[model samples]
Target: MICAPPEKIFRATRNRPALARERARLARAALADCRLCAHDCGVNRLAGETGLCHAGAEARFFSAQVEVSDELELMPTFSVALSGCDLRCDFCITGKESWNARAGLGFDSFQMAERAKLALQNGARTIMVLGGEPTIHLPSALEFVSLLPASAKLIWKTNAHGRTQARELLDGMFDVWLADFKFGNDACAQRLAKVSDYVRVVQENLLWADTHSELIVRHLLMPGHVECCWRPVAAWLAANLPGVKVNLRAGFWPAWHARRHGEFKNSLSVSENQFAFGLATELGLNLIP
Candidate 1:
């Protein structure tokens, strides 16, 4: 099936200056006791305190480029790789660069807006905010989104473990959500990402995201986790969000500190990929090729 061209939601709200101001105000408030992600660090970012994500009041990003290797639905996209993350995934490809929020070149909302303009000129229809996790800097992200041109569709690529209150505050800003449903169970989550209640938090956020935006759930097929992670995630998606699209990714490779973990030390095998694909098909999931 041919996917439709990206639709811009910000156009309708562009005329409403008050709405934009209100959103900015609320986003700034969230920084007082940063409950942006599931970590709920509650650090006063405005007062120069850093949270678990290590992000401060200002927004920082490592790179901005036109990427063609994303999902087909969001191809020819302009991606902004933000700094800092709530989760410390053992296999993080970005390495320590993403972990240190202050390492990247800092950009205020105006600078990001200027970058978006250049991306749009280069024929990018989608503008994706990625990270360590973009939601960690909610106020800056929202401010940048507000400054963006209405021609490009906004896509937020996240860990899907953000606080519900933060998600509510960002209600009408995004057009699509590219979420990582990394682990299906809590034990793996705590062991891998150092987060508790992963399943519940991700599920609640996914349910909320599906209602507000076009949702695409991605699952990395990890070794020795087909039954524990893949099957359970597929079953849950089939039962609760049957219409949401799934991307059963087989691109896991030993990166960062993954070598220390026995399970994530190697790349996903062909057989493991096949099993995950077969499971998703059996569950009647709408998959993205």
Candidate 2:
């Protein structure tokens, strides 16, 4: 659980919609010289120029549905999956849609917000803005936030690879930061997800998120990375963000380009799963089982 009362967040976020609108405006303006993600690709997306993420001037989404397949405390969430990502994780399960920014329907923030409001009315506990990595679609994401119900719990589900400008714009808007810590080091991150300076960027985002909002960290146990990936990740969490809610997920389905790497050719073994869980417990991490 998040260890926070819903009413406390509700009381504090009365001005969230207004603040999101202002941030949305700023985000759109930044598209002229984009620095949203850690890549710092200064492509002028406003002029049909593309960057590492390949996303253009508008936001697109492949899915928007209410689902309970999330952290227990934040279940029954209305998930809005934006279509593009900055990193190129070859084993991405949603690669067909996520790797290509132009793969989905163009977003209409007001319409999507209305749908999310209806979801809230129908018992959805949170409105989750996820991606491919929402930072790439900052303007639209913030615009969606600006239109959501002020009392609705909002979750920013991310890969934790955003830059300082994004963190500032997202500062006080989200109720929860459901982020992923995929790799423990830069070498593995570069080999697996094609991202550099990974550990520093993710840790910075996590530390800031922990201080700013209700944060939950999740690491999907890979078949051959128990020692090199999860071990260091768990150790860091136990040492730096002790007591933070962590979810050590064991399911690892090899999808998309997973076949390209030997380690990604199969599912996580029972031994790997057991070791990962045991290590998390031994590290005294507050795992949300």
Candidate 3:
């Protein structure tokens, strides 16, 4: 499943197929007893147990076509944010929306495909699949990608905590990977993302991305947590993955219980002068400045 060029995408979707019914079918089947994401809560979404992701059989979510402005090179990339994340990052910016998985509007697979179509119509060259962790709704996600024309390049933004599930989509389904290294150490990972094996899953999935598509690793610099938290993951990527691009995100706006409950109250955002960026430079990573 080599990623086809833009022209191919356009051509493939010249006469877009009607995908609503098939998407519905798959959604119903998957939600019957969902194992779509790594959490594998196995709760019957149709009965609406709302597993760890809080997503039910109904893919309720909010969507908008946004032009990502971070990467100058990818100037015209369109982004779609799906609601609900498996990990409740203390510094989550979209706390209002993603914290409880109840924030975003739910949409069917056809609706999602239309969003991608809208992105292309709006002059975007690529579509970014972001979420409450896209894997939360694996069947719908896969069906959405399958409906799109091959020429449309897809970039999946993930926590990289679900490599086995993520790997299932590696066969030419996605063109780029915009992944995150949320916790630098096991303790931080457990306390922060609530998953001690975060790094292990990410490392394995990253290797899969390296062989399959372009990989960009993003690390948010948390205040007072740089040395004890961000450095280990940064060093690991630099040594184990040389060509992968690194985005030392200076934006970690506090959200959720961060203002009072979590460890981020009165936290300061990272600037160009932050220490993490300097270490990334020293590590010889393909820094995204």
Best by TM-score: 2
Error of 3 at 203 (Å): 1.7
Deviation of model 1 at 147, angstroms: 0.9
Query: TM-score of each candidate?
Result: 0.92, 0.96, 0.82
RMSD of each: 3.3, 2.8, 5.3
What would the TM-score be for candidate 2 when compared with the true structure? 0.96
lDDT (10s digit) by residue, model 1, range 166-227: 78776767778889999989999888888899999999999998878788899988888888
Each model's C-alpha lDDT?
A: 0.83, 0.91, 0.68
Off by over 4 Å in 3: 1-33, 261-263, 267-273
**Model 2, which residues run further than 4 Å from truth?**
1-12
| Candidate 3: tens digits of C-alpha lDDT, residues 211-240 | 666777888777767887678987898789
lDDT of 1 at 159: 93
> Which has the better TM-score: candidate 1, or candidate 2?
2
lDDT of 2 at 30: 98
User: Which candidate should be chosen as best, given lDDT against the real structure?
Assistant: 2
Q: Which prediction has more favorable TM-score, 1 or 3?
A: 1
